[model samples]
Target: MSQNVTFDDRDQSVLNYSPGWFLTGTYNATSVGQTGTLASSSITNVNVTFVFPTPATEFFYFGIKRCCGGSYLICIDCDPNDRKFITIDAVDPTDDGQSPPVVLFSQKFSVAGVHEVILMNQPDPAFGGNSQITLDRFELTVPDPNAVQPTSATSANLFSTPTPSSTAGPELVGSASSSSSNLAPILGGVLGGLVILLIIVGIWLLVRRRSRRTLYSEEQATAPGPQFQSQWRPNSTFTTLTTPGTTISTTTSRRELDAGRIYSTYTESADDPLPPEYGQVFNTAGPSESSSLEPPPPPLPLKASR
Candidate 1:
């Protein structure tokens, strides 16, 4: 069961309850208690606050009614900081003379952060009794009129008009493919240039190696530089270079000698003896020198004796 709000015995602190919109009421109840009631001839007002924590762009729905058999006006007290309000008139009834219980109103009101919506009564000048007004339910919601929908703009009622489409044709697919193919030639040219650079570097290395070999052959031919000739010659002598302060030591090789023989025989007979005529020529005196001088002395002696 839904609860009912009644102003049974609420003493009039001021002329009216300054704030708070009436959510649910039976305003014609004539009860009096600590909880005050709204009457048909009594005048009261409803206050509302429109709040948005973020920058919200939505429409709002509010419902209102009157139990009395007269017209009533819902006046909105705009934000004094910013003048903005909505006025709804509950002036007519249904064919059965029943006033509309719930009416939804929405607008494209862009609110920044937070804003308050105040609902106040437009005190009518004709009636003087404590007349009454009632509120059922109020809500601020994004407009979604249909529960199940494929597209919001499209309606199940075919009588309603339709919105137009926003897309183009399939030629865009071919154009995108052609644009990608045009880039392939540029990529191939870059790869071909890199291959040519590698070929050039490889040929340069081959030429350098050939030139190095040619220089090495030229050095080799200019001087046969000592062919390693190993013709064995016995009893050859060569000077052995020694350090300035040291003698070059020749290692004596040992040879096993026959027990009865000696090495002196080999050294003495190894060379022929000098010729005896070389010594006789230097020792002989000449015979002609003494004979000539002695013959002249003998002739003089013979003359002197005769």
Candidate 2:
């Protein structure tokens, strides 16, 4: 079954993307894409997939290099069978060179050079956004021979993979990585993931029914009467945080709710290292709502400065 809808230009809030292809391609964003192509489709149940070969190493990053408009679901080899996708929004409207590769999906394997990347248009209808996605470029992090490989999954695999602008992969030693290639580990992982997903779905459905019943009541409670409304808003603040070698600059909105309770709101924005998981929401209003959903495109050549 398909919606058969065509040619929709949706705002960041209500996500709905066009369609692309399984083309093998690459892109370099000067300040947004200059030499790349975009895919537009009219079907609601299709995926625009892209594939490329990556050399074996201890670490690698797969991101959309172009900073344009689209949302995509990135996966390693065939993890979880695409039943659920972690989407990265590539709808950044800013060209300040501060944002690209909107969201980064970095995963550490039991062994390197043993997996592949498959990107597709978001398949979850619950995402409630456009169905289109794009991939202009991919960034990879070849392992550093001088550093010991991380063995534990807890070891930060996220931003821990970014390299300085002058970084390069270690010289090829041998074909040992290829000789030891095995699928047992990845296959086991996929099975375990499916089990966990079933548990989550059961819990989620129970919660979903409750949430719907209380949805109207919660909305009604959030509205404050004239007497309870507070006109005073705390000054929004900007802060820059540095971890290891990466610097994250963030802006937070502190607002006084109706009962004089102050809460800080955080959303996806430029300078943030990671994108939020879809469906997570805060008490967003006015400017914050729009900014969170459209923070640059994901899957870019991550340029890190030392």
Candidate 3:
């Protein structure tokens, strides 16, 4: 026998068909008939409980319709196991046609008996009149023992739990802060090294320039003094003279001299006075020559008037 519960019949008492099933909530049992179908009223904080029959298959399905745009939270409580929650956001379409129903919950059972499902309506005030949900149907299918299990069952969980969160927002912010913090030291080190190098280069250049200047100054101080040339001039006139046995001609030139020596030029003459060193030669001269020599002049009386 197929095990299913469908809320489409518009009869609220049909829900009592399964003795193991229970439902409670503050909501209307049915809505006004529209076209060929009827829908259940929107409900909030609803609870549904049921027991799975033994020897049943692994899949169960729950169908619901979103009447408006809003968010909802569904929580399932399976005893002796962890509770699980799923959040759903819905949007109303612009088309006037009826929106299709979707599977609100599905699970594969490991150990199943009694299970409670809680639905929390999170209506958005911004959605105005469109925030609601309606129940359509539910099914518990028992597939053939030899049949292949569908891949879609992996998403469905019977006693599934949410893992710990690994959000990236905080980690990204920390990394950015760390990088910025390290940047200052790196820049400082580079700038400091550059400044020291510039100082060293400046000192080197200054010392080199100073040494060059000093060498140039020393060369100037040790250099030789200026040299002077001597000027010469010839006499404007020459004198001619005669001697008994020889004729002579003489001319003189003038030149400036240093303090160490004095020079004078004169011609030889026979009438020139003889020095005492030549007295013997005069004494040896002939008597007639001696008589011809003139006598020396007498000195004046010192006191003739006295």
Order by lDDT, highest first: 3, 2, 1
Candidate 3 lDDT over 1-306, as tens digits, reads 234433332344432222222233222223333233333334444333334333343434333445356555666554436656677665455523354455656766664344444544555555663455444444555545455455545555433553445665775667668889999899999999999999999999999999999999999999999997765445323445566666666544333332222222233568978543333334322433432223344333222121
Predicted candidate 1 versus true structure: per-residue lDDT over 1-306, tens digit per residue:
111112121323212444443422442222322222332223454443333323334434333344332334332335477655445544333323233334535444553223344444554444443334444333333323345455543455544643443563455556557768998998999999999999999999999999999999999889666669786555433334356676454432333332331112122233658544432323222432211112122111111111
Q: What lDDT score is found at residue 202 in candidate 1?
A: 100
Superposition error at 206 for model 1 (Å) = 4.1
Off by over 4 Å in 1: 1-23, 26-45, 50-57, 64-83, 86-97, 102-104, 109-116, 122-134, 139-190, 193-197, 200-211, 214-306
lDDT (C-alpha, whole model) for all candidates: 0.42, 0.47, 0.49
TM-score of each: 0.38, 0.28, 0.30
Weakest 10 consecutive residues of candidate 2 by summed lDDT? 1-10
How far out, in Å, is residue 114 in model 1? 8.1
TM-score, structure 1 vs. true: 0.38
Backbone clash numbers for all candidates listed:
19, 20, 0
* Candidate 2: tens digits of C-alpha lDDT, residues 58-143: 32233442234356565556655555565655544444433334324555545335455555554334345544454333444444
RMSD of each candidate relative to the true structure: 20.8, 61.2, 25.2
